[model samples]
Target: MTHLPEPPAAPAAGQARIDDQAAKLLAAVEEAMRTPTSYRDDSPLPDYGPTPPVQQPGAPAMSQQATDVGRAAMFCGLATVPPGLIAIGILVASEHADPTVIGMICAAPAALAVPILAIARLLRSAKPEPEVHQHFHGNVTQTTTHSRTSGVWAKNINQK
Candidate 1:
């Protein structure tokens, strides 16, 4: 077999004019892109004045009043359970406590509470209450590409 050539022939000598033309065109394009002029309006966009305030919608379900009510209920439950449990022990231990009278004493708070709750509920229901319904829906997708000019330049290129 014939021996292969040691050096590859370069086209740069024969195609010098074409290479120069291509380089000039590339530079022109780069300069144009850097500060575009032809067919491009680079002036600052006409001040449309300050933008109108955007109304952001919050979750309808997570109101401050609802959170307060939930906290209040939790606090009431926590405050009431231990004492009520202890009272049961006291009732059981008292020898003078009649079986019938014990139940009435235990149920007295609840008996008073139920009617007050019912009346409060009825009074609340009686008013022509306003129904507020708010819905917020959105699909957001964001993408960002960044070049760390200073950081990249500061780094040693030879380092692995």
Candidate 2:
């Protein structure tokens, strides 16, 4: 039989000490990650000083009422063609008159109505609503002014 030399036993005490130190270091890292602290403690924020006022270009302003009137007028103008066509179709189907006469009769009403309605809308929109004044008392002086121009007359407010 061949004889073999026995392997040396590992240094159990030294290995145990090293493992304990490693576990402690891992736990310290985990704790630090869980609760972070600022590098500069008890320090105030740095100031950059006062900022200069910026100039902005003034935008072209249009009143809500005027916008509504313009939109209504546009819609009326667009609507003129459809009703005229419908009227002419009805007249022709009924054999009320010649094609030329039917076209003139139908077109006249539509043409007149469109302008009248547009003018009416404009006139109605021109009437200004009562102004409202709100007063605020505080360290900062603020005054808010607004007018009530919203109603059935302002139906085309969102058209713009």
Q: Tens digit of lDDT per residue, candidate 1, span 90-112?
A: 77787556778678777888999
Residue 63 CA displacement from its true place in model 2, Å: 36
Can you tell me which runs of candidate 1 are displaced by over 4 Å? 1-61, 95-102, 111-160
Encode model 2's per-residue lDDT on 1-160: one tens digit a residue: 9999864455465455556689999999999998857443445545786655445448556899988998899998998788778876887798876778767875787798899999998999899878867666777765455446766676333321
lDDT of the structure predicted as candidate 1: 0.73
Give the local distance difference test score of model 2. 0.74
Colliding residue pairs in candidate 1:
none
Local accuracy by lDDT, each model: 0.73, 0.74
